[model samples]
Target: MTEVLFYHLQNMALESVLPPLLEKSLERGWRVVVQSTSEERADALDAHLWTYRDDSFLPHATWRVADAADQPIILAIEEGNPNRAQVRFLVDSAAVPADADGYERMVLVFNGDDADALAAARAAWTDCKARGFTATYWQTDERGRWQRKN
Candidate 1:
């Protein structure tokens, strides 16, 4: 069964939070696909990942790249997994894809301060549970450490 995780971001920006998670995913030897809500967002994420940290590097490309299959991470605005990733990260209120179960894990990263994002994350949580996926919720503590809530 696919393990679904909901990451609620309250005081942090996605740009600050995502790179480390992506790096950790790579450390686990998991290929990743980050699905955003728009082409512009995807492009921005692609660029950010490349320069997020001076001491780090993430091997990635956009879905439009000819060698997408060869990348460890791929930024996309749609459902298909062009990179054959084992994990998928959904950002910017991106919906849970219909093909959610195709991956080993699905992560929904939402802005807690955004009303629409909170609502969408709630709905996605319900949907994942109904589909029998092992869904878990996580929130950052006062010091920005992730603590699993449920």
Candidate 2:
């Protein structure tokens, strides 16, 4: 069973929060896939990943680009994983299919301020629980660090 992680974004934007998680995953030798609801979102994330921090480098590519399998991180609007990622990050309420065995873990990041996003996350969490996947809820602390809520 795939581990489902729900990140409730309260104090920061997705761009601000994503890089560190990606970095940690890379440190663990896990290739990553970031999925969004549209091409524009994926493109924006692809651009952001390049310049998110001046000191660090995240080698990533959009799905439309060539040599996708060579990238450590692949951003896409589609569900396909070209990089053979071990972990997946689903942003902006991106839907997760019923069978998610391709990846070892799935991370769902949803904005707390957006009602629709929260609702979708809630629904996904419930579905994941019903499907017998191990689900965890994480929220930011006062210092803006992630703390497991449930």
Candidate 3:
């Protein structure tokens, strides 16, 4: 199955998502990869998700292009939010590209708020689509698992 997720992080709370998402994904035998728009954002993600800076997600997030073949990868978008404890805590305002060689499977996890963040993620998604990879912007609609541009 091919997938690309651009869900909204309403309030920047790990409790808001992460746990259930990661648990469910990993259980399904998927390898995860994370990408941050900036080094600071990557660091913050490390501080928040990995509980340490030298962890898998932490290091992978910094990589300009990360390929996790035979594994699921998560590219965490770093929107500059001040309050780390809450969502909407996007501190910096620029979004960088997350591109690299090798591998074709990816799930771009990003906050749906900030225009910049959305733009950056969209670019990556577009790249995914261009590369002939199964790509789509997904969200929960009235039913479930909505993927299609409207």
**Best of the candidates, TM-score:** 1
- TM-scores of all candidate predictions against the true structure: 0.98, 0.96, 0.50
Cα lDDT tens digits, model 2, 33-148, are 99999988888898898899999999888887789999999898878889989999999999886446667899999999999999999999888888888999999889888899
Q: Across residues 1-150, which tens digit of lDDT does each residue of candidate 1 receive? A: 999999999978999999999989999999999999999999999889889989987899999999999999999999999989999999999999999999899999999999999999999999999999999999988888999995
TM-score, ranked from best to worst: 1, 2, 3
Q: Candidate 1, residue 58: CA error in Å?
A: 0.8
lDDT of each: 0.93, 0.90, 0.44
* lDDT value, residue 97 of candidate 3: 30
The sequence of per-residue lDDT tens digits that candidate 3 reaches over residues 8-103 is: 443354333554555455566544545444776656665565553343342223233434222343334542211111111122322223332232
Q: Ten residues in a row with the worst lDDT in model 1?
A: 49-58
